[model samples]
Target: MRVVHRLFEMLIPRRPVSHQAKDRDNLQDWKNYVYGRARSAWARGLPLYGSSFRFTIVYLCGDSPADIDNIIKPIQDALVGVVFSDDSLVSDVDSHRRFISDGIDLTNLPALLIEGALSGEECVYVAVDSAGPLGSYL
Candidate 1:
């Protein structure tokens, strides 16, 4: 199986309100950034994966906490055409969020931590691949 990974080295924008007259600008901005990143990554010519794919996302954030569902929806939508041709092809999604220190620690861990005890700049890592019979579900 081949897994394609892309990291957007910044905090993912939250899904904006959907009232067309109210938050249109915010909604558009969020979509622009997310889609732009996915489009750029897609340009790398990764293989067009088959169905039964897995999607994994790791979000490293600072002190402020955000709703997991809100954070993941944009990413899932952004990757539709770029990663899997369509979202229906995805069969599994595993996602996580951590305040840097809550993740793997190394002797050099302190160097990566900041005043917030995590990198001030949030990071979103997305990995996708075509695979089957994964984990306990299989």
Candidate 2:
């Protein structure tokens, strides 16, 4: 999931607000929406790199569908010969699914932990349900 994490870090520059913050509700909504898109992408065998892949661009504070589209415009412009779309926004599940189906590899995406502040404090962050690709990709 390094790729996903790295991409997320790159895309979102500011440190994320603590999960307890009131704004966190909005953040969580966006996070969940993005996670679903990633899950769908992983189900399909598509490479994350290159123009053919569609990326989910997130806007944190005042993020709207139109705002995200504007932010990712440059990324799309730079990478010519590839199809890119920013159809999903925070709290929008239908658009998220549509973007995921457009062909982005999300095999390395991180799973969301929705509990709360206590959940964030846990040392063992995440657990996988099945024996899946972990070290193979690296």
Candidate 3:
């Protein structure tokens, strides 16, 4: 079974927030906000399926510098119960960082391609694919 799930511009943290003395409050706030958004998005989307799957996270940036690693953690954590039963079901994971510049036609960009682009505004895409136990290797 193959399943693809997506959460639009729901906030994703670049990294797990550190609970250092100075940044505790801010970090907690960030964690709360991101986690809440992810949960809400997952709750509203299609139900999860598949015991093992490949997950892809595409980050759309708007003229800002961000670490891909930092952005994926909150998402992975938040999806634990909502998307899959647990994060371990995500056997293979990949991430893509994209920069959308002004005046660049979005229609022709290969990386920006999505399954249903014509229906709504562009946002982050999370795709999960389960290749049926060994996929093509068997």
Candidate 4:
């Protein structure tokens, strides 16, 4: 013999001005707000995938407060996990050092010495090729 189960509904109170009513209203507003925020955020982020990649050298350029904040915000949001050099560790260099430093792991720091040496050599070669003063003679 086969048995069939019937669905039953319990009538819950839909009282307004009560805690449940307030919670329902708050939940609806929260859902709408979150949906809007997600839509806007995805629209803004979508273009990044199609954009050409530019390798930026973030050396000491004496950036403005807003510029620094703008650069840091994306890194923080993406959780890129940056490892700062010694110069970045000096006193009073960064105001939000405490917050920024917390996520970084020192063990994963890139080799500055090797990178600097290689970059300098590459720049010199590029400069020599561009400064072709004795072009016709060659």
Could you report the Cα RMSD, in angstroms, for every candidate shown?
Answer: 6.0, 15.4, 6.5, 27.8
Q: Order candidates by lDDT, high to low.
A: 1, 3, 2, 4
Candidate 1 lDDT over 1-138, as tens digits, reads 333343222233332222232566775666677777777656545535555777766666656655555666667776766666677777787776767646544333222122223434566666665545765444
TM-score of each predicted structure versus truth? 0.64, 0.23, 0.55, 0.18
TM-score of 3: 0.55
| Candidate 4 per-residue C-alpha lDDT over 28-125 given as tens digits, one digit per residue, 9 for 90 to 100 | 55334433433433322322221112112222221122233333322222211111112222111121211121233334323432242333221100
Clash count, one per candidate:
0, 0, 4, 0
Worst 10 residues of 4 by lDDT: 122-131
- CA error at residue 60 for candidate 3, angstroms: 1.0
Off by over 4 Å in 3: 1-28, 43-50, 102-123, 131-138
At residue 126, candidate 2 shows an lDDT of: 18
Name the candidate, 3 or 4, with the larger lDDT value. 3
Worst 10 residues of 3 by lDDT: 114-123
Candidate number of the best lDDT: 1
Error of 4 at 68 (Å): 32
TM-score for candidate 1, please give it.
0.64
Better of 1 and 4 by lDDT: 1
Where model 2 places Cα greater than 4 Å from the true spot, the runs are: 1-9, 14-51, 63-66, 78-138
Model 1, position 4: C-alpha lDDT score: 34
Please provide, for model 2 over 4-108, each residue's C-alpha lDDT reduced to its tens digit, 9 standing for 90 to 100: 322221222222233344564755554554344444434324323322232343333222122333334333332222122222211111112112223334344
